[model samples]
Target: MKPVRIKRRFSLGLGGFTYLFVTSFIGLGAISSQTNLLFWTFGLMVGGMIVSAIYSTAMMMSLRITRVLPDHGAVDEPLLIRYELTNRKRMIPAFGLVISELDGDDEYLRGKPHGWVLHCGPRATLQAQTVGWPTRRGAVHFNRICITTTFPFGILSKSIVVTQPGRVLIYPKMYRLRRKALWDIHSRDMIGSRNSNEGGGSEEFYGLREYRSGDSMRHIDWRHSARAGKLVCRDMTRLTPPKLMLLLDVRHRGAWPYDTAERALSFVASLVVQAYMEGFDVGLAVAGTPCPTFTPHHGRIHRTRILHALGELDFKTDEPGSWSTHRARDVNWMVIHAGEIDELFGPPGAHHLSDAELDQWKLNHDGKSSRVNLVTRPRRGVLIADFSEGVS
Candidate 1:
């Protein structure tokens, strides 16, 4: 944690404004009538206002708040932003504390969520969380936090702004692939299996050698051992899983609909997750957006890297005129286009998904038949397909 500057400010609520108006009227009447009762009432009102200001200022002065935010968030999911509130004063307890983000992206954070704490005793620290729904994807910069309190009296609202800068990466929404038709139809050839040359697990037989003392009996070749009059062991090789590379094309010349682009990214993200789960190395390549290419690899970290790249894509700097047809060998290429598909983007025999089929990739909310059926079209340099076929 770094040192942060704090700023203090105050605001008057509606009740406080009405109370002041009434107190002024009472003081004016007292002065005009020279009545002791009216003067006493005005004096009490002034004293209460003074007390409210003093208490609120003190409460906000001796407070410290630290934000606990996650590294990244997923779109269409609840983002739990936490806060640690500490009371520095030994005697004065704080109440009605509120913590909220300052200058946050309203698009990324659907609503301005606030963390509330009813009470925090003197010299006590409490953790509170506020749930915010992330409706958009991209980077969200969090610059300041405002902790306000209107305790003891509702007249004055005192707040302290802390300059704590941070960033949260919001990933595109992903859904489960209901149908296995896509993988089932092309996985075998696209993600071809290869056997490792190194001696490894018993998935594939490699060769035979003299059995060692510590060798498992199951791996011992009994017939070979008897023929050779010595112990023989069967060596095996591990089968290497195929890899899948996603080439996302989001290129646009000028004003393009963001809904289509976002959905395309979401579909690619879902494919990355599903392929990783199905034991394939997943990689990503963005053609339109200014993003680096990710080589095919396996593991949770690699998958996160792909998703993070997708989240960081900026369509404003997209290269509309730039298109490449070079395809990496040995890995399955799945080209997902945000708009119309271009033949020069991918090589022949490559799997192509367009905006028309992006909606079907989403999980149906009404518990309807969402099973996907692959529909193929005439081969026109690049393979055009759709998941429009569904079971009722």
Candidate 2:
């Protein structure tokens, strides 16, 4: 077991100040009036401050704290971090212990919050819970906690800095793809229905069945139906995965460059989940200095890998210089790029920015990209630095 780090600090609190003030007044009266009673009163007041200091310091020193973190955390989600606080002293109990992460006034810091322990019996252990929220997807960390207490006497307060190494990976916040809006994509027939072999389609043709009402007109085997003098639809085994290539383009293209980039990343996360669940063999392409790539595959493990990689993206760091042939050469790639050219990185906690707040973030459109792509697609295996870069 590692040693529990304990540092002590003392500050005059309400009760301490009142006692000191009275003592000072008594000392003044005793000196001027030659009153021995006032002298005794002054001595008692000074002694009380000394006692308060000792008691408060001991309460803080006798306690040790260890943090219990969850398996993982996610952006924009509440994660509970547990603190097990134990009092080591046999005779004295500790009270009003506040354990909190020290946050600077700078707006970019997104880390843990504070927790409190109201009471701990002598030589006993107590468990307290703290809720931490992550505002960004990536590595979240904590190094020290500010533990404070004014135990025994409300007058004297002591705070100590407890140092601990802490780190947790935060997965990207996923949004469900709006099915209603996606209907437009489906209607445009942009979602490829792979077909080639005589058995036809990705699924092998099993046989034919009488056309039911509301059946897709496209499924009708007209030749077979004519031969049988009845309306028939082809039945095919549902196999062969739908192949999709997700291209994350980081170039900012429009006015709300920061908002657009983050929103695009979120949308990408949602699409990955949606595609995988729908049986799409999904591959990922990212433009980064050391870009992380995944071949189109299937399984829950693959999904986890994707989410983990997605969480680590620092958009300002990576750039897809040119499109190069990645793993699969035949992917029907959908390239989603946030091609806004401005380099303004938003607040670190910008991921938590509300719509109203984001709207306020917009400034003069000093956008370098002559044009913006709401979203775009590229040919399978073809690389384009930007959609406007023209397909190879």
Best by lDDT: 1
Question: Model 1, which residues run further than 4 Å from truth?
Answer: 179-182, 188-190, 209-217, 225-232, 252-256, 318-328, 367-370, 374-383, 386-392
Compose the digit string of candidate 1's lDDT tens values, residues 274-302. 88888887778877667778877899999
Global CA lDDT of candidate 2, please?
Answer: 0.64
Model 1 Cα shift for residue 162 (angstroms): 1.7
TM-score of each: 0.88, 0.65
On residues 258-326, what C-alpha lDDT tens digit does candidate 2 reach at each position? Answer: 766676667667778877777677777765334577878888899878888787777665454333544
- Could you tell me the TM-score of candidate 1? 0.88
The local distance difference test score of each candidate is 0.79, 0.64
